[model samples]
Target: MPEETQAEQVEPQPQEPETAPEADGRTDPWSDPEAARREIEKLRREAAGHRTKVRELEPLAAKAKELEDAQKSEAERLTEQLAAERERAAAATRSAVAAKVEALAAKTFADPEDAAGALDLTAYVDESGVIDRDRIQADLAALLERKPHWGRPDDGPRRPAPDRTQGSSGNGNRTPSDPANDFANWFKHSLDQAR
Candidate 1:
């Protein structure tokens, strides 16, 4: 075995790193802890910078969209406005139709819920959103004829007799005879019951 010089040992060490298994041609920071930390810090700073740029651009983007809208041709703007008006008008029409339907249903159905579940309200409105009052009245009349029970149970309070004073004789204990001379008989009857 030969004794090696320090300079010779150091000389081969510099070349070994190039052919070392741990070495690769790439420059990514994963191979070095300090380099990875610096790279992570740099990426964080770049992300913060991009975030600030996005924040700065936010108002400009809104303004650009506004300007684009402002610069639209009159026909285009008018078309959009007309479309919005049409949508609002349609909503108004639907609301009006629903109100009318509810009012009509309240008059016709004994139960308001029955009108909601049993009837197809669209049948009362034409394509132009005009309600057909005649048709609704006729249909309700027809429904009452088909299912007579569906109508409001007669208009007054339900009771066994109309006037409470009418057909009721005096307290049911005595016969339907004059009571002027019946005190003794009534007393004896009461005593008998008490026994």
Candidate 2:
């Protein structure tokens, strides 16, 4: 094979015109320096505004969380308090009813000692007139001055005396005229008897 000469090695080349149309026929959007700069500034400002909004929202989110936590805590506390109150009320009711039942049993049996032995005092009375230990205890404690005993019917319960100073003159066998006063007295009496 002969060595190729320099002129032969150089290939003929064709040249096109310097002016040409863009492939998509569109100019660069950033060709306007001022407009491009303004666009960049606008983007920067928008980003800054977004950051500011985020900062502002952080505190609001935190406050919302705090409020939610506080509400949950308050709700829990209230629920516990309500449960405790209900338990207290139930206990009071049971005790009062028991006292009434004991008193009723003593009267019905006509023998305090025998009545106590024979009765499950809570079962003797209902809201209407059922006899139960709880009812007996409540009635005796509320109505009687002396504590009721089951040993023997030596004497009947001592009824409360009317206050002469208050001009209250009743046989004392009936409940007080004022419902609140009556309930208070009865509850106090029931508590004492239970103890």
Candidate 3:
């Protein structure tokens, strides 16, 4: 047990060289070319297996993408169809309202445009496509009451006054004053005399 300096006190032992791990974990195969070749072949087999799996799934992936695209196109077509249907419905409704307004005005007044201008057509039509006739009549009556001049006379278009001179006989004698002794009756009498 003599005292020794730090460098001298330490003794170096024979060291084993470190090598890379093998597949079996028991031996270092780097030194043997045959073992390295076997490992490379094993890795190549594994890579081939992975490639085979990817090949098997390729068709399925393509089919899934195709189905997704089909569904998207179908949805877009349905959306366009819905929009077209809505436009058609709106146009039909507008035409129906205009026809109804024209018919109502013609039935109630002399001037259809003036009658249409006085009432709200939307109010008289319900969602169920039923027209409120009573309400329309009431509204029309109220309108006529408010503007009394809007009421059309029950008598139709006026006719010109009859020409009394045309009914006189050519013999310088005036026709009878009786209501039935008009030009028509006198013409019938002259025709009977000729027969």
What does candidate 3's lDDT look like per residue over 79-180, in tens digits? 999999989986676557656665765765667667668777778778887777777677777877787666666787789898866764776776547666
Candidate 2 lDDT over residue span 87-174, tens digit each: 9966776556555554565553445444454445445546664445455555444444343443345666887897754644565455
User: For residue 134, what is the lDDT in candidate 1?
Assistant: 78
Positional deviation of residue 110's Cα in model 2 after best superposition, in angstroms? 9.7
lDDT of 1 by residue, 1-195 (tens): 122243234322222222234446556555555555567668867988999999999999999988887877666989999999999987786666556655676765687555445556666777877888778667767777887776666668767757544565677553555576588789989999999
In terms of lDDT, the best-performing candidate is: 3
> Mind sharing the TM-score for model 1?
0.33
Q: What is the TM-score (0 to 1) of candidate 3?
A: 0.47
User: lDDT of each prediction vs. the true structure?
Assistant: 0.67, 0.61, 0.72
| Best-to-worst ranking by lDDT | 3, 1, 2
